[model samples]
Structures are given as structure tokens and as C-alpha cells.
Target: MTDSGAVLPWLVIREDDNGNRYRVGRYATRTEAEQVADRLGARAHERLYVVERVDRATA
Candidate 1:
């Protein structure tokens, strides 16, 4: 769960380089996220992950 208490559908692509995390896109399903991750990971040498994300919002 995120700070906003909402679970997002899917986080498509995430890249971590030098301890910096970058969110690329969000998808409707995990399968879709994984597909994009596979393609991006093949080209990117940095740490990449495709997973679900919880929505976070400042209150």
C-alpha cells in the first residue's frame, strides 16, 4: 500500500541507475508491463524492473 492508500494497476517500467529510480510508464496488466520491461531491459544495461505500484499522494 502507498501513502495514498491506493493500489495502482501496474507500473510498466522502472530504471535504477546510480541509486536514482525513474518511473517510465504504467500499464493495465502485469503482462503488459513485463513485455515492455523485457524490451527495455535488453537495451538498457542498468537495473530495470516491471512491477505493480501503489499510488502515493501528499496529504
Candidate 2:
């Protein structure tokens, strides 16, 4: 997890019973989802999200 109003990016990772990995979403800014990942730690699969600034129309 990152500090509030952090400009850093974040990733949301989730695993299923079969041990499949998935990325729920990518955020340009740190959010609650990132915090969840931090708390879950190694128990959860890794999903990386990079911080990128894009035009709203293109994004």
C-alpha cells in the first residue's frame, strides 16, 4: 500500500481455488486495493500496475 494521495501506481491481484492469477484492475494512483494487497502479502498472487498519465479521451 502507498500513502494517501500518492502518485505511485498500484496493482490488484486475486487468486482462485485452482491457483489462477488475475488482475482485477490497474490504478494510476494508490488506492484501497493496493492496501489490501499489502495486507495479503505473499498469500496472494502478484499483479503489477504501473503509473502512467494519459489523456482521458484516449484512456
Candidate 3:
């Protein structure tokens, strides 16, 4: 933590059966990320996650 005090962007990702993380997409808002996560979860047979991605702006 570099004390940037910035809100990072969100990402929607899927962890397949092979334990590989694949980015479904990136969103500017958490709501958008969660929406995509819901859609993917419905069809996903493996793990799905909505997580914050460290933005370059903060770096």
C-alpha cells in the first residue's frame, strides 16, 4: 500500500476447472462488475469472482 487513497477499478474473472484465471472483462464500477459476475456464475461450472484491480493511476 503506497497510500494513494484511490479507488481501484473492478474486474470480472473466472477460474476454470484447470485453476486458470481468465478475465471476463473490466468495469469502471463495482455494479457493472457484479452484473457480469452474475451472468457468468449462472453458466459457470467453476469458480467466478468479482475483484478490484489495482489501477495504473494509483501506481
Index of the highest-lDDT prediction: 3
TM-score of every model? 0.63, 0.36, 0.64
Q: Relative to the true structure, how large is the alpha-carbon lDDT of every model?
A: 0.68, 0.52, 0.71
lDDT of 1 by residue, 4-36 (tens): 665556786565786666777766667778888
Model 1 ranges with Cα > 4 A deviation: 1-8, 55-59
Candidate 2 least-lDDT 10 residues? 47-56
Which candidate gets the maximum TM-score versus the true structure? 3
Question: What's the lDDT for residue 18 in model 1?
Answer: 67
Which residue pairs in model 3 clash with each other?
A: none
Ranking by lDDT: 3, 1, 2
TM-score of 2: 0.36
Sorted on TM-score, best first, the list reads 3, 1, 2
Q: State residue 35's C-alpha deviation in candidate 3, in Å.
A: 0.8
Residues 1-59, model 3: lDDT tens digits: 32466443677778877778877776767887888899879876767665657567663
